[model samples]
Structure formats: structure tokens, C-alpha cells
Target: MNITVVGTGYVGLVTGIAFAEVGHEVICLDVDEIKVAKLRQGNTPIYEPGLESYLIRNIEANRLAFTTVPTQAFAEADVIFIAVGTPERKDGSADLSYIEAACRTVAEEIRHSTVVVIKSTVPVGTNECLETMMNTISLHSIHVVSVPEFLREGQALSDTFQADRIVIGAQDAHSSELVRSIYEPFERPIFLTDRRSAELIKYGANAFLATKISFINEIANLCDELGANVDDVASGMGMDQRIGRSFLRAGIGYGGSCFPKDTKALVQIAGDVTHDFKLLKSVIEVNNTQRHRLVAMAKAHFGSLIGLRVAVLGLSFKPNTDDMREAASLVIIDELLESGAHVVAYDPVAQSQAKRILSPTVEYANSVTEAIDQADACLLVTEWDEIVDTPVDVYCKLMKNPVLFDGRNCYSLDEVKQSTLTYYSIGRNDIIHAYT
Candidate 1:
């Protein structure tokens, strides 16, 4: 199967490479010639584990190729994937400029009776709009299909190969068959539906996940106020078969490319139809508020953070990826600096991107221990492995007041009990303020 994937972003590159790995001939297209050149030379623009190696292997094996010319790539391809970016607009709607542009390009470029699949996350009715646009543009039959990707950043490769399910949406049975054939190698259960449902499914999934994070964060706050341990509360609730355990961990809220934008877009879309999605609206509100929860907690610990040296452990939204799109660490860093606290941060892979965003305003530490040593207090914003495993006593020996605020609850109360320092975390109420 010869597949042409447009837009060499995270989704496009990952999707293209994964297909090529499974013995499909793939030509990855990008408008940016520089990016195409870099990808051709085996230089991945993003930091996804196993992606670079996989891309290199496929490229070396002649299964995967990169180019800026979509028409040239799409000429021989049976499946053309529109994996472009649909960045969020200021009004909280998904800006479909890239999607429109990609569809137009595919419509004009496609020579065969091709299936143009939308792999990008778009609002409902987007696939229908593309199908109409393509029909108007081409004399030959071009079927537009909505095939939304559910790939997580760090585990994208594994997720794509072993996807829980594949959603294939098309207007007619012919287009749907072509879409399924393209994904036949995946061996996953395929959910065949109308285009609108497929589009809504992507948004719905992200919004629900975001809502869960917000709900737990709200619970974490309540625990903090009522002197209850959120960890136990979460555990107790998760034991129920209904809740089961993913995305229930209360932390500094979700901050990634998908959740923040998708939740906002869904809320705006609902408002357009005069439907008030109050729950989703609150989900966004709760997540935005949760970002600053650590800041408020920090302020409470030290009356005025002015001139205080604060250490921020972890800079990425979540661990295992170097994407800082909507990372909570950015909010925490800004708040700390705003309150006149000097912020030192560390992340294994995201430090370079963090440096670009954070710049000289905050100090970038070489390692987790380096960030925490001699700081007035430390906040574990993102629960990275290195930060979680750091010795709590190290801060006890180095800082004037060894205080630890566990935003992700990376440390147990018992672990911090032995140290001659202050420990505050979400939900566990047993460890009261030993000092003050």
C-alpha cells in the first residue's frame, strides 16, 4: 500500500513512520522544505521515544520517504492522510486553516481514485466540508474520510501499532472500504461510522479525559481544605468498576497539545448550536485554575515568595515527551517569578524547549538534584521518574527551610516523615504541619 501523509508534524511523522514500519510504502509530505530535508536525513523535529530510531530504520530500508511535493507523492498513493495542525484560535475554536489548505492541496493533487483521510482532530462536519470541497475541485472521484488519530505523544508508536480501536468514517461504503484497507495491517477493531461521529469522537474523548483531570484536581483542593488525603480518596473511588484507574491521578492538571485545545473547541462548538456544554466549560475552567494551584500552595507555604529561591521539578506537561505546548510548568514558573521568587527548573527532554519558552527569566538546572539543592522550597510539578526518585533528604541538607510541595503526590507521607523537613501533598491528611 502506497500512502501519502501530508504535514510532517508529530501526528503526520508518527503515522507515516508507523505504517512504513509495517511494510507499507509511505511518502511523508510537508510544506516546509527544511523540515522535509531534516526528516529525509533522519533528523526528527520532535522528541518521541523510539520514533527517531524507527524512522531511521524505515528510511534506510527504503520503505519511508519524505518530500515537500504532495502532488508528486499523492500521484501513486492509494491513501492520502491529512495530518496537519488544527491549532486553537483565540476564540477557543479550532482554526481549520491548515486543514482547509491541506484538503485543497490534496483535492488538486490527487490523480487516482484516492481516499483522502483526515487524521487531524477537527470539529464535527469538517469531513463533510472537505468532501464537498474536494468534489467541487476534482472531476475524478475523491472520497474524503475522517480517520481521527488517538496517539499519545510519548507512547505514540506503540499506540499506533496496538491501537485499542480504529474509527473509520466515510460518506459511502466504497470510501469506507478503502479506509479500512489502508488500516488493515493494524489488526485492530475498526468502528465504521458517519464522518460527524468520527469527528465528535476525537473531541469527546479528549474532553472527557480533561474533565476527569479537572474533577480530580477539584477533589484534591477539597481534600486540602477538609484535611483529607486525595490519594486515598482517588484510590477508593478508582476501585469502583465504573471509574477504573486511568487519568484519575490528581496533579497540576493536564497540559498537552490535545486536551486543552480540544476541550475549548468542543465548548465553543456546543455554544454555536445554542447548546451549553456546562460540564465541558467547567472542565476547561478547572484545568486552567488547577495550573495555578501549585502557585497558591507555594504562596501559602511562604507568605511572600519575594527573593525566595524556588525549585520547579519537571517542565513538560507530562513525562516521556518533550512537548511544552500547554505544560503546567509554564504557568507555575510564571506565577513563581511574578511573586518575586527565583525559579530553577529541570526536565530530562523538555529542557531545551523550556529554555526557548522560559528564557533567562528562570534558571535552568542541569539535573533534578541540582535544581532542588539549596532552594527555599521545591514543587514537583510534573511527575518525571528522576524527580520522583530523588532523595528527599538532599533538600533537607542543602536548603535553609527544606519544604517540599508534592503536586503529583510523587512521595508518600512516610517517605517524607523521616526527613527533618516540611512536606505537603494532595489528599493525604495524616501528615499535618509538624512545624509552624
Candidate 2:
């Protein structure tokens, strides 16, 4: 199969590469000339484990290519995947302008019958609307299917090949089967549904996962109040087959490309139909509030952060990815900046990206020890192995004053207990507040 993937973001890049890995001829199309040039030379613009290696390998095998020319990408395609970004609007709805542009480009480029798959996360009814637009504008018969992607940034390629299920949404059997054949090589379960259900499935899955994260954070809050450990609470709750343990690990909050954007979109989706989604609303509220938990802990410890030198251990939304979209670090660091704390952040792979988003006053560090060295306090934001695996005693040894505020609960109680460092973590009874 010759597959043309339009857009070289996380989803598109991974999807195109994964298909090429499975013996399909794949061309990834992007508007950015520099990015296309880099990708052609086997340099991926984004970081995902084993993706660049796969890109290099597939290009070497003559199965993968990158291009900025729309006609060239579309001319040789058995199917086209619109994996462009649908950024969030201020009103909590998904802005479909990118997908609209991609569809328009598809209309202008493709010359024959094409199976157009919508791999971008879009609102329901979007695929149908796009199909109508394509048919009306183009001479070619256009079949738009919704096969929304669910790739986590850190584990993108692995998730693509090892996904539990592959969903195909199309009106006609031909387009649906063609889409299925693309994923059949992976041997994952293929779920065939109409366009709307498949679109809803993506949003619904992300919204539910966000709800789980918010729910656990709420439990963690209660644990803080009742002096009960959230870890034990989550463990007890997750043992139930009904409430399995996936997003049960409580932390500051979930912030990446999907959860924050999709949950808000889901809420907006319900509100558009005059139905209020109160639970998900609270979930968003809880997550927004969760980022401030560490800051609140900081204020409680020190009456004023007017001139404190604080070391932030991680910057990316999570480990293994440089993406900081809606990251908890953004919120936390913003609050810290406003409070007059001098912040030095350290992330192995994200510092370069974080520098663009963080305040100019915020400093960058090469390593965990460098970030924590001579700082007054430390906050563990992302649970990067570089930050977590560092000895807990390093904080006591390096910091001018060893005050650790752990947002992700990266270190065990035993690890911090033996150290003279003042440790404060979420929903844990083992906080050593040695700083009176």
C-alpha cells in the first residue's frame, strides 16, 4: 500500500513511519520546508523512542520519504491520512482550521478516487462535513474516514505497533476495508464503526482517561486532608477489576497534547447540545488546581518567596518527550515567577524547548545536580529518570538549604527518610519537614 500522511507532527510522523516499517511505501507531507529537509536526512523534528532510528532504517530500505510538495505526496497514494493538528479554541472547542486546510489541499492535489482517512483528533460530524466538501469541490470521488490516532508522545512508535485495537470509521465498506488493510499487518484487533462513532471513540477515550487522572488527584487531595496515603488508597481501589490501575497513579495533573485539550472539547461538545457535563468540568477544575498544590506547599513552608532560589527538576509535560503543551511545569513555573522565586529548571531533553516557553528570568541547568546546586529549594515536576534516579541525599549535599517539594512523588519515602533533606510530596505521610 502507498500511504500519504499529511502533517509531520507526532501522530503523522509516527503513523507514516510505522506504516513504512510494515512494508508499505509511505510519504510524509508537511508544510515546513526545513522540517521536511531534516526528515529526509533522517533527522526527526520531534523526540520519540526509536522513531528516528526507524525513520533512518525505513529511508535506507526505500520504503519511506518526506516531502513538502502536496501533489507529489498525493499522486502515488492508495490512501491519504490527514493527521494534522486540530488546535483548541478559546471556547473549549477544537479548531478545525488545520484539517480544513489539509482537506482543501487534498481537494486541489489528488486526481483520482482516494480513501481520505482523518487521523487527527477532530470533533464529531467533522469527517462527514469534510467528505461533503471534498466531493463538491473535487472531480474525484473522495471517501473521508475517521481513524483518529491515540499515540502517547513518549511511547508513540511502540504504541502504534502494539495498540490493543485499531478503529476504522467510514461510510462505505471499500474505504473501511482499505483502511483496515493498512493496520492488519500489525495484527491488532480492528474495530469497524461508522465515522461518527469512531470520532467519538477517540474523544471519549481521552476524556475518560483525563477523568481517571483528575479522580485520582482528588483522592490524593483527600489523602492530604485525612492524613491517609494516596498510594495505598489507589492500590486498594485499583485491585477491583472494574477500576483497573492505569491512570490511578496520582500526580500534579495530566498535561500533554491530548487529555487537557480533549477533555475541554468533550465538555464543550456536551454544552453545545445543551447538556452540561458537570463531572468532566470538575475534572478540569481539579487538574488546574492540582498544579498549584506544590506552590501552596511552598508558600506554607516559606512565608514569602520574594528572593528564593528554587530548582525545578523537570520541564516537559512528561518524560521522554520535549513537548510542553499545557504542561504542569508551565503553570507551576508561572506561579513561581510571579511569586519572585528565581527558578533554575533542568530536563535532559526538554530544556531547549522549555527555554522558549519559560520566563526569561528562569535559568536553565545542564543536569539535576547543576540545577539543584546551591539552590534554596527543589521541586520535582516531571519524573524523568535523570531526576528520580539521582540519590535523594544529593539534594541535602548540594542545596544551600535542602527543601524538596515533590509534585510527582518521584522518590520513595525510605529514600528521603534517610536523608537530612526536607521532603514534601503529594498525598504521602512520609514528608520530612526538617526546615522549621
Candidate 3:
């Protein structure tokens, strides 16, 4: 199959590369000339694990290509995937301008019958509207199928190859079958449903996952008040077969391109239908407040952040990807700096990307030791391997005050109990240094 994937962002790039890896000829289309040039030179613009290697190998085998010209890529393609970003608007709705433009281009450029697969996360009824628009504009008949991607960052390749189930949503059986055939190479269960249900599936899954994180964080907060350990609580709860644990870890809260945007968009989707989503609204509120909890913990310890030097570890939302969108570190660092603290931050791979959004006043450190050296307190934001594997005693040796705030619960209470540093973590008892 000749596949043309529009918008070479995370979803687009991964989709195109994965298809090409499965013996399909794929052309990844992006409007950015520089990005296209970089892809052509076997360079990936993003930092997803195992993506660059597979991209390079597929390109070498002539199975994958990249282009900025939409007409050339779409002309003879059998499947066109709209994998553009659906960023959340101020009102919490998904901004579909990019999807509209991509569909318009596909409608105008395609020369024959093509199955248009929407891999981008959009609001419900988007595919039906797109099909109407494509049929109206195109000379040939177009079949628009909703095939929302479920790949996770840092593990995109594994998720693609080993997906639990594939959902193919189309109005017509022919379109559904055609899309299903494309995934025949991967022996995964395929679910066929209407476009509306499929669209809601993606949003619903993210919202529920976000809810789980918020629920655990709330539980962790209560545990903190009761002097109970969240780790043991989560472990005991996870033993139940009905409630298998995945997003049960209590942290600074969920962040990334998906949960924050999708949860808000789903809330707005409910509003459009005149349904008030109060539970989801509270979930969003809890997540927002959870990010600030670490900052408050720091302030309580120091009495005043003024003239203090704070060390921050991990700037990315999560480890293995250099994405800083909605990262807890951003809010924590901003609050720390506003209180007149000198901030030094470190991440294994995200420092460069972090510099773009973070204040120029904050200093960047190359290593954990450098970031924590002579700092008044240290905050572990992202649980990157480098930060997690560092010796607990290093905090005692490096920081001026030796106070550590573990937002991700990277260290165990037993380990912190043996250390001389004052330790604070979510949903756990604070380990105060004897001298502090």
C-alpha cells in the first residue's frame, strides 16, 4: 500500500514509520521545509525511543520517504492519514483548523479513490463532517475512517507493534474493511464501530486515565494527613483483578500532550451537548492544584524562598521524551523564581527544549550533581533514570540545606530514613533531618 501521512509530528511520524516498517511504501508529508529536509537526511526531529533507528532503516530500504509537497505525496496514495495536532483552545475545544486544511489539501490532490484515516485525536462527529467536506470537494469518492492512535510517547514503537486492540470506525463496511486490512500485518484484535463512538473512545480512555491519576493523588493527600504510605496502599489495591494498576502512582499529576488536552476537550464536548461534566471538571481542578503542592511544601520548609538557591531535577513532563508541554517543573520553577529563589534545573535530554519555555533567569545544569551543588533545597520533578539512580546520600553532600522534595516518589521511605537530608514526597510521610 502507498501511504501518505500528513503533519509529521509525533503521531504522523510514528504512523508513517511503523507502516513503512510493515512493508508499506510511506511518504511523510510536512509543511515545514527544514523538518522535511532533516527527515530526508535520516534525522528525526523528535526524541522518541527506537523511532529514529527504525526511520533510518526504513528510509535506507526505500520503504519510507519525506516531502513538504502535499500534491506529490497525495496524488497516488492509497491511504492518507491526518495525524496533525489538535491542540486545546482556550474554551477547551479541540482546534480543528489543521485537520480542516489537511483534509482540503487531500480532497484537492488525490487522483483516485483513497481511504482517509484520521489518526489525529478530534472531537466526536469530526470524521463525518470531514467525509462530507471531502466528498463535496473531490472528483473521486473518498472514504474517511476514524482510526485514532493509541501509541504512548517513549514507547511508541512497542505500542504500535504490540497494540492490544485496533478500532476501525467507518460509516460503510467497505471503508472499515479497507482500514482493517492495513493492520492485518499486526495480529491484534480489531474492533469495528461507528465514527462517533470511535472518536469518543480515544477521549474517554484519556479522561479515565487522567481521572485515575487524580484519584490516586487525592488518596495520597489523605495518606499524607493520616501518616499512611501510598505505596503500600496502591500495592494492596492493585492486587484486585478488577482494578489492575497502571496510572495509580501518586505524583505532581498527569501532564503531556494527551491527558491535559483530551480531558479539557471532553469536558467541552459534554458542554456542547448541554451536559455538565462535573466530575471531570473536579479532576482537572485537582490536577492543577497537585502541581502546586510541591511548591507549597518547599515554602513551608524554608519559611521564605527569598535569597534561597533551589535545585530542580527533571524538566520534561515524563522521562524518555523531551516534551515539556504542561510539565509540573515549569509551574514549580516559576513559583520558586517568583519568590526570589535562584533556580538551577537539570534533565538528561529536555534541558534544551526546556530553555525555550522556561525563564532565562533559571540556570541549566548538565548533571544531577551540578544542579544540586550548593543549593538550599532540591526538587525531583520528572523521574528520569539519571535522577532516580543517583545516590540518596548525594543530596546530603551537595545541597547547602540538604532538603529534598521528591515529587515522583523516586526514593523509598526506608532509604530516606537512613539519609541525613530532610525529604518530602507526595502521599508519604516527610523525613526530617535531625539537624533541620
Candidate 4:
């Protein structure tokens, strides 16, 4: 199959590369000339695990290409995927302008009858609306299908190839089969539904996962007050077959591309129809408050953050990606800076990206050791492998005060019990250094 993927962001790039890996000829189109140029030269603009290697392999095999010329790419393709971003609006609704623009380009450039797949995460009924828009604009018969992507950022490649199931939402049998054929090589279970249900499934899935995160974080917060261990509580609860654990880890909150946007969009989607999603609303409130948990802990310990030297261990929302969209570290660091705390931050891959989003007042350190050097306290925001794997005693040895506030609960109580650092983590009893 000759496939043209519109937009070379995380979703588009991963989808295009995944298809090429499965022996399809794929061309990724983006408006950014510099990004397209970098991709064409075997460079990936985003930091996703195993993406650059797959991109280079497919490009070397001549199965994949990158381009800024959408007409050329769209005209010669059997399938065109609208994989652009649908960012959140101020009102919490999904901003579908990008999807609309991609559809307009497809309507204008498509030369033949093609299977147009809406792979971007869009609001319900968007695919049907897009189908109507395309038919009104173009003389060519186009089959529009809703095939929402379920790839996580850091593990996009693995998730794409190893997805538990694929959802194909199309009005016609031909469109369903065409979309199915694209993923048949992966041999995953395929669920066929109407366009609206498929769109709802994407948002619904994300909302549910966000609910789990918020639920667990609330439980963790309760545990913190009651002198209980959330790890043991989560483990006990997850042992039930009905509640299989995935997002049950007690952490500050979820901060990535999907959960924050999708949850808010889902709430807005309900509100548009006059249904007040009260539960999801509280979930959002809990998550917002959770980001400030670490900062609160720091303030409680020291009484004042004015003129304090604080070390932030990680910047990315989660590990293995440089994306800082909705990252907890950003919220925490901003709050710290506002409170007059001197912040030193470090991330293995996200330093440059973080620098762009974070305040210039933040001091970027080259490594974990450098970031924590002579700091009054250390705040672990993102649980990167480098930050998690560092020796627990290093904090005590380097920090002037040896106080540690762990937002992600990166270290175990057992590990901190052996160290002289005063450790405060979510859902765990504070481990105070006898000397401190």
C-alpha cells in the first residue's frame, strides 16, 4: 500500500514509520520545512524510544519518505491518514482546526478514489463531519474512516506494533476492509464499529485511565494522612482480577499529551450535550492539586521557600521522552520559582526542551549529581531511569540540608531508610534522617 500521512508530529511520524516497517510505502507530510528536512536526512525531531531507528531503517529501505509537498504525496497514495494534532481549546473542547486543515488539503490534492483515515484523536462525529466536508469539496469518491491511534509517547513504536486491539470505524464495508488491511500484518484483534463509537472509545479510554490515576492519587493522599503505604494498598487492590493494574501507581498526577487534554475534552463533550460530568470534573481538580503536592511538602518542611536552593531531578512529564506538554515538573518548578526558590533542574533528554518552556531563572544542570550539588533540598518530579537508578545516599552526601521530596515515589522506603537524607514521598510515611 502507498500511504501518505499528514503531519509529522508524534502520531503521524510513528504511524507512517510503523506502516513502512510493515512493508508499505509511506510518505510523511508536514508543513514545517525544517522538520521535514530533518526527517528526510534521517533525523527525528521528537524523542521517542526506538523511533529514530525505525525511521532510519524504513528510509534506508526506500519504503518511507518525508516531504513538505502534500499534493504530490496525497495524489499518489492509496490511503491518506490525517494524523495531525487536535489540541485543547480554552473551553476544554478539542481544537479541531488542524484536522479541518488536513482534510481540506486532502480534498484538494487527492487524485483518485482513496481511503482517508482519521488517525488523529478527534471529538465524536468528527469523522462523519469530515466525510461530508470532503465529499462537498472534491469530485473524487473518498472513503473516510475513523481509526484513532492509541500509541503512548515514549513507547509509541512498541504500542503501535503490539497493541492489544485495533479499532476500525467506517460506514462502508470497503473502507473498513481497507483500514483493516493496513493493520492485518500486525495480526491484532480488530474491532469494527461506527465512526462515532470509535471516536468516543479513544476519549473514553483516556478518560478512564485518567480517572484511575486520579483515584489512586486520592487514595495515596489519604494514605499519607493515615500512615498507610499506597504501594501495599495498590498491590492488594490490583490483585483482584476485575481491577487489573496499569495506571494505579500513586504519583503526583498524570501529565502528558493525552490524559490532560482528553479528560478535559471528555468533560466538555458531556457539557455540550447538557450533561455535567461531575466525577470527571473532580478528577481534573484532583490532578491539578496533585501537581502541587511536592511543593506543599517542601513548604511544610522548611516553612518558607524564599531564597532556598532546590534541586529538581527531572523535567519531562514522564521518562524516556523530551515532551514537556502538561508536565508536572513545569507546574512544580513554576510554583517554586514564584515562591522565591532558586531551582536547579536536570533531565537526560529533556533539558533543551525544558529550557524552552521553563523560566530562564532556572539553572539547568548537566547531570543528577550536578543538579543536586549543594542544594538545600531535592524534588524528584519525573521518574526517569537515570534519576531512579541513582544511589539513594547521593542526596545526603551532596545536599546541604539532605531533604528529599519525591513526587513520583521513585525510591522505596527501604532504600531511603538506609540513607541519612530526610525523605518525603507520596502515600508513604516520612523518613526523617536522625541527624536532620
Highest lDDT scorer: 3
TM-score for all models, in order of appearance = 0.97, 0.98, 0.98, 0.98
lDDT of 3 by residue, 82-182 (tens): 99998989998999999999999998988898899999999999999999999999999998999999988888989999998999899999988888988
lDDT of 2 at 432: 53
Candidate 3 clashing pairs? none
Model 4: ten consecutive residues of lowest lDDT: 427-436
- Alpha carbon deviation, residue 170, candidate 2 (Å): 1.4
Least accurate 10 contiguous residues by lDDT in model 3: 427-436
192-229: candidate 1 lDDT, tens digit per residue: 99999999999999888888889988998887767777
Worst 10 residues of 2 by lDDT: 427-436
Q: List the residue pairs that clash in candidate 4.
A: none
* Model 4 ranges off by over 4 Å: 430-436
Query: Candidate 4's residue-wise lDDT over 322-418, tens digit each?
Result: 9899999989999999999999999999999987888999998999999999999899998898899999888888889989888888888888898
RMSD to truth, every model: 1.5, 1.3, 1.5, 1.6
